[model samples]
Target: MKLSSPENQAETAVTSSLQAFLETDIAPKANRLDTDTIALQRALSQLNQFQFLGLRVPKVYGGLEASLLTFRQVQALIPRYSGAFAFLQTQHQSAASLLANSENQVLKERYLPAMAKGETLMGVGFSQLRRTHNPPLTAIPVEGGYQLAGKVPWITGYGYFQYFIIGATLPDGKALYGVVPLIPTPQPEGGNLEFSSPMQLSVMNATNTVAATVENWFLSEEEVLFIKPANAIHDSDKKNVLHHGFYALGCARAGLDILENNAGKKELPFLEESHQTLAQKHQSLSEAMFAALPPTETSFQYRLSLRVKAIHLAQRCAHAAVISSSGAANAQSHPAQRVYREALLFSVSGQTKAVMEASLNTIADYV
Candidate 1:
């Protein structure tokens, strides 16, 4: 699809707005985190002002309602300035997508407008779906709603997001999806909700990821989104791997840009050749993956392969960036080092068992 087509004009406008925002508001403070954490209030406020927090929400709800390809393009723009900001924004986009596609009109009416207006922010707590056996959280049917118990391993944007879309497995093996307020009023009355301190990570430490323990927390029908059987969830999830690919590609592109800018005159030949090769690969894979949207099993596998390739390319480009920067790259504040760490995060992000096994098998064949 031609990105410059009239159909994509709206998307182009949003992208342009995002670029301006990144250059002005986010870039200067992108590397400077206060106490190793972002002050999300200011960041979120800026995102709201730009209407970026609702980039994917439907126009009916007062959002820009960008296309999926356009959304991916926007995703690729942010990590160049701040990986932590990009990561956090991606989760909000995911949550908005879920809400946009939900079957519950009441829920949508209640939250979608608020989300679009940036009055409400949402996080995701569905990483437990990655577990192949013995899921961390479970659901039990009660008179009014489902009772939730156990822990959610990771939920980012803790302080910023007021709500989260959490998934739990039912007794009949279907997946139960619901939204719960992160900070309940009056302290949940009886210790039903609790959260751990934010985790410290090697990279993206400013995102403020946290773990939550829910003990018999109740979610009524009003709060529940849509429930899906295991097969349906798997089918939906397999198509999402491409989003990760775009993020990795963004990091790789950032590194390549840094490397090219810093290359000495004598080193320009090698840097130019490497840059062209990686850029061509990135464009080809990105086009192929987007063309395979509404992914079938075969397409899903193909996209997974592309995801692996993107991660590998990002790592190589990040390393090349560091090498080009030489001793200067070793500093804690070096952009090359930050890009390198961000590249490492792609390997584990959005990982499922099938993806993990496929990546391992691919590496084994290469070795």
Candidate 2:
């Protein structure tokens, strides 16, 4: 896990490159267009030039083939410059991971290399999988393929993503996953596919997130990824919550960085002590979480607990930055205020019922 290790040297190089990009390009305009969807497109194009869209893709497909740990580290650095950028990139990375790990040879051959080379960008539309009420999206077997009919509540990076990986439940109680174009030509009126206007939000409005409805959308066999039983999906999801902690930690680290840079000699000792304490906790929890990869139920529970802790610490650190800056931090453009808003996003991102229950139980013990 050491950054200096030979196995991790490539990760170091990527991180260094991202750091330079953040400082030189992203940070300068991070607060300039919080309400502009076009801003995300520009940032994504810049990221494509750096091969960031392919960070996790296999080397054979022209990607950097970074390890999961390295991917988390790079993700952690992104929110420091722009949380919306990090959020969109996370969706892209998730899609890339799905394509890379799919069992369908044709699906892999058709998309992985294009995705790795930045010629294709895919978004994820699986939030419907978490709904507790009403039936989930269903797939009906048809002559040439399956017909998908249902609604996907939230999909980010809308205009920027050419395609999306959607999930539907089969009648026999299996999950069906496929990649479909976001905007198909010959608009299907009340058929096939349609999307709503972008949602307005208190923050990260630049991401262009939207809701979509698919009415008997046909997904040919070649378009399908892998189908798994419901239980398998549940099992896989439980172990994947740890990477989200890095996003919160990244915002916290950004706040701390701002505080340290602005503090005078007299304020240095107190600020440094606070920074070190949180940094140590973040490092310790990160190590433990990764060590438990492909986690068992016990380890999954532990990871959720640590995730909650990281979220609260991020909020605290961001709040501390606001305090240090006094009245100036009240400005919407202030980095401290931005980090504070970004910290709120971590609570909901990648959230599940199990994670929610665990977070609540942990909070109750202190209350």
Candidate 3:
């Protein structure tokens, strides 16, 4: 798909095609995907048909094997069309990437090819491993493998994904990652896995976020994805901290799209002028974040500062979109309201203690 090149702003065939597909199919019905499960599932299936489900999977696994820049571009591009679509599909893509990197050849071969082609869709629920409090979920060593017990606080895409990779803490503070069914599993080997109803949320509700109460859920060795030492996720979060900002970057674009559209519809000179100013700020932030990506010596603190800036910029752009949309933005179906809520998600998604402090500090104008 001509996915990668040296430049960040350079348009690739993949991104161009994705943009065309999104604008034609997804953008027009962004609001519907938030509330309509059938429409959202159809949109996801179309994405699979186009092979975008495999962007991060290795070529050996029937994936595009695109560079990080290419994947990040897709990350930014999708949310502009539909935040719900972006939010839902990313869970599958994350699972694919993890499988691609797994040492379990059997597990990788069993899942990666199908995952890449969306023949066997998957979701991920490892965020609970990042919580500072006692692990909401725990893993106990057993003869064949480990038994998972406790609650998986968040696992999006219930019906859309048949399976998901779960993370639970072990006694030594390490974590066990395993692929398990998304459905309520029977009490095989004297264990049970049950999920709650779809979580009611302000945004991306159609994605069917759910929680699981896993009681001694037997996980065979073949089902294990991988295991990591203590503090691995935290260290990884610090390294890839800027990745989620790509969503905010695209959301800023969504807000600007609405602001510019309203500027023309209302023919308000002040709105147009405000759009121009915000657009420039968005551009500067986008470039700085992109340049700080890979092959650069950008320090952790600097990248974090860029992330904080992107979060704040997204909120500002969303506010502007809401202001331009005027009183009508209060409607649930309003695009401005959708983009505003998306901005809220990006502000806190993948948040760590350090990111939280920085984001809150920026919120307080403590910059």
User: What are the TM-scores, per candidate, against the unseen true structure?
Assistant: 0.91, 0.90, 0.96
lDDT (10s digit) by residue, model 1, range 242-326: 7677788788877887777776443768777777776787677667656765533456677788878777878888998898788
Consecutive 10-residue window with the lowest summed lDDT within model 3? 3-12
Clash count list over all predictions:
0, 0, 0
Model 1 TM-score on a 0 to 1 scale = 0.91
Candidate 3, residues 1-367: lDDT per residue as tens digits?
A: 7754543333376678889999998999999998899999999999765668888888788888778878888888898888899999999989988888889999999988988888999999989998757999999999988988999989999999999999999999998899999998886478898999999998999999999999988899999988899899999999998989999999999999999999999998999999999999989988898899889878999999998988888899999999999999999989999999999998988889989999888778854
TM-score ranking of the models? 3, 1, 2
Q: List residue ranges in candidate 3 displaced over 4 A.
A: 1-11
Best by lDDT: 3
Q: How accurate locally is residue 62 in candidate 1, as Cα lDDT from 0 to 100?
A: 85
Q: Give me candidate 3's TM-score against the actual structure.
A: 0.96
lDDT of 2: 0.78
Q: lDDT value for candidate 1?
A: 0.79
Number of the top TM-score candidate: 3
C-alpha lDDT values of all predictions: 0.79, 0.78, 0.90
Better candidate by lDDT, 2 or 3: 3
- What residue pairs are clashing in model 2? none
